[model samples]
Target: MLDVGSGTGALTRVLRAEAAGDVVAVDADPKLLDHVEGPTVVGDAFRLPFPEDTFDLVICQALLINLPEPVDALREFARVSRDGVAVIEPDNGSVTVDSTVGGESALAGQAREHYLAGVDTDVTLGSDAESILADAGLDSIEVTRYDHDRTISPPYDEADVESARRKASGDGLATDRETMLDGGLTADGYDSLRQRWRQMGRDVIEQMAERTYERTETVPFYVAVGQV
Candidate 1:
């Protein structure tokens, strides 16, 4: 099995543990591939460095959503895999957030809408993987959905603390300033939104400090498998 875009070997480790045969980790970054325990290769997803029919199965996680030409990349995956190919991608458009703090969910949704509109790639491609696989000329395609739920509650961790701080500073929105602007958000609109976002972050911090903060986020991921 070949794991494409195996960044930091998180999925690679899981594959190695569960698979019957060997799992080869491949990525564009050599530094990330170095973290894998077994065989690793530095390869691009658009052009896998392997001959046709090289592996029984090829898989990728959270990859297709970031690519502008996902079908082209799937064709490449098909070229290398003799048997089947699987891709796990998230539907960012369908994500949902629930927070005890007032206005957090609305502000997050507003930001996400702008971000999705600004991004070049199809960030919501997970929901359309079936048709994409068909376009790649793969058959026997099957797709399954998985919801990743993230919750924050009483026992706050360091990561949670940092998240609050980032929100309070409006760092998260600032990071995507260019994208948001490109998505048609005016400078004044962005400034107003950021100001509200920062206030919401402060509210989150206060809630956390009082041990009354509660939030839940759900992101749906689709696992599409197709015969090559």
Candidate 2:
């Protein structure tokens, strides 16, 4: 199995335990490679280093959208795997929050726009795993949807808040000028944002904990598996 963009080897570790064959994990980040236990290589996904038809399966998670050229990357994945490829990515089209309590600040709005652009790709490709695999020439594709929820509470740390902020304030996605500080969400503004974010978080948690906001489409995870 070839695990492309295997960050921190999380998926790699899981696959290692589940699959009997050798697992070769690859990523561009050297720091992430350091934590991996088995065979690991630092390389680009667009241009994989291995020879053609080197593995029985190639698996990727949360990787396609990040690439500059997703189609090319898909073709590369096809080139390396002889038998099949399994891909798992967030269904960006399914991304939604019940409310924008803060009235969509520039940073936040931009975040949404950035996400929309990438999601457009997913939408164009059917916004599911089946489309991605089929488009990449994989056959007998199967897609599975999973509900993934993340709840944030008080004592909210900067890292957690920032990650959420970044996701909300997608890369150059927002058009508003005021919310964005010189084109980016600065470290300083994060604390103030956190206070506001915490209020929203607490509201949702309280409402949901009280069984008020039921079955809200806040987060969703999707998986697609198929043969090459």
Best by lDDT: 1
- Model 1 Cα shift for residue 16 (angstroms): 0.9
Clashing pairs in 2: 110-173, 110-174, 111-168, 111-169, 111-170
lDDT digits (tens) for residues 1-228 of candidate 1: 999999999998998888899899999999987778779998999999999999999999998888889999999999999999999999999999999999999999999999998999999999998999999999999999999999999899999999999999999889999999999999999999999999999999999999999999999999999998
* RMSD list, candidates in order: 0.8, 6.7
Off by over 4 Å in 1: none
Q: How many backbone clashes are present in model 2?
A: 5
TM-score between model 2 and native: 0.66
Candidate 1 Cα lDDT to native? 0.94
lDDT string, candidate 2, 110-188, tens digits: 4444335433244323255676677778889888877666544444456545544543443222333244443355646
